[model samples]
Target: MAAYTVPKAFPTTVVGSYPKLPSAQEALRRQRKGEISEDEFKRLVREAIRGVIEDYIWAGVDILSDGEQSREDMVVYFAERLRGYAPGEWVRIFDNVYFRKPIIVGRVEWVSPMALDDWEYARSVSGGRPVKVILTGPYTMLEWSFDLHYGDRREAILDLARAIRREVDEYLARGAKYVQIDEPALSTRPWREEAELAGEALEVIFRGVSAKRIVHICFGRIERILPYILDYPVDQFDLEFKNSNFRLLPYLKEYGYDKELGYGVIDVHSLQVESVEEVKKAIDYLMKLDIIGPEKIYIDPDCGLKRLPRRIAREKLRNMVEAAKLARKEWAGEE
Candidate 1:
């Protein structure tokens, strides 16, 4: 694997998902209720994915994805595909959102390649732009699922690390340039011991694969994980700063974080779209920090746009790209 380089300063991208088309969402519900055939559900999912990819291209996003339209939830999607996991009762994650929690009934195993086809399809439709292959990290997958089989949590996480690595290897073999491991649960861990264990699990997952490794951790006070997380073997850290009002930047600078930074300038949790100027302001503030250089910065939304309206997600991405262009010009001293 070659060194991953940023194409340009403030290159705009997304954090994996775009809002699912309403029809696609309905197809998911119908499929779950057995009201629709599996073939019918997959056809609608493909259509939704293609439309989302088109939106990304139209919005001028620098890096693209398949919008994760085929997935209901990140962890559960993989759980459904991987062996040794059984769906339990629906559990509430937040207000009005629920998922069937996964229970580990046996040793976790990777029966086949997951997301490789999705990556291939996304790359085919990307108009030659790099498409990021995203997956739920081992630590997050283990943390999110109930461990009824593995007696020790550490053992379970490590097993998951091995299982997910197989999927990563397949993605690389199929020509994925960038791969992001979504580990949002890392920040919210109740104990530092768990965080340490999670770090070890990351090493197991990331050791030697090497294709521009990125870890996206969001929605929690990252200050807790800090310099420890910086030690993880990854090229770049994709994180949420907009939702936290860029509070982590000071900590990052204080801790002397030296890796490439994926800065989030748009808040995905809100319906209100950020203006071009507002987005530019966020980027400008980070540029002035001097800790992360312009060449190392990649701009994106705070997190996935799955909860927001589809039109709003598209508009937000357009604003993000426009902001990046203006920021690039300013950094390059162009009028």
Candidate 2:
């Protein structure tokens, strides 16, 4: 069981939102309209990223993320940013959900160290509160992207992991303390034959990142695969809580896991802001178990705040942060 330690000050973070630039909306519209070139869209995305970082910093968030506003698609853009990858045609996940695929045309090559200036921008925003850097996990990146070169997904994931590891080192060298690797696809249900293969990919992807890592297992059936991740050496597990997967909390107890849990107390999927009382209720639900502690827990929304309007997102985060403060005070029996 994990021990409790109330943070001196409430520590709050989001999966990745706050740095998306305003041009994001227009860029999306243009991309859908097929009116802009890929290169132009990427430039606009960079601008939107700058805007997101500025907005989040001004909003008083303790830990800020790049908001990932500029990339045409989250996983695909990572491919476009790399040197040895080719932008493949667009593919749909289900119905209307579409993303570009980066085809692995050649062996991975690094022309320059991959870095997003979101952390530096956030430091300027918080006057320095340790910006939380966000990236797509190598496993998710490989699975999400089109790989034409390698037959073995493990090799592809490991290669991608090594490239991203270099990027992580660069980000940490630039002073990033908290790095979030988003593996949303981990929740998808694939055939049983693919499970071990997926696990292998996951193992290779996380091989060399630092100790302060957050593996975001959003958008998937976490209960079935929590065991695979429980064995990994990540520090925090950021999963969806505002939505109905509260069943997984008990699974943490069942597994006797002891990492810090980031609970999504507010509903970021909607415009409605969660009340401080609601936030308390969420934490109280988790605190009922002795496996995790209040201090080891971080409060947040269900996921990224990108789709939310600026005012609504701000209000939602403000209430969530305030709720964390209130919860901390109450938990400590402080006035």
lDDT of 1 by residue, 1-335 (tens): 33333356777789998898866798788988999887788778777877888999889898888888878899899999999999977889999999888888999989998777667777777778788999998888887888899989888988898898888888878767788989999888736787788788778767887688899999997888886777888889999999999999999889998898889888999999999999999988887888877778889998899999988988999999998889989985532
What are the per-model C-alpha RMSD values against the true structure?
2.7, 4.9
Q: Please estimate how well model 2 matches the true structure, expressed as its whole-model Cα lDDT.
A: 0.69
Q: How many residue pairs clash in each candidate?
A: 0, 6
Query: For model 2, what is the alpha-carbon lDDT of residue 91?
Result: 84
Off by over 4 Å in 1: 1-6, 35-38, 333-335
Reference-based TM-score, model 2 = 0.83
How much lDDT does each candidate structure score?
A: 0.85, 0.69
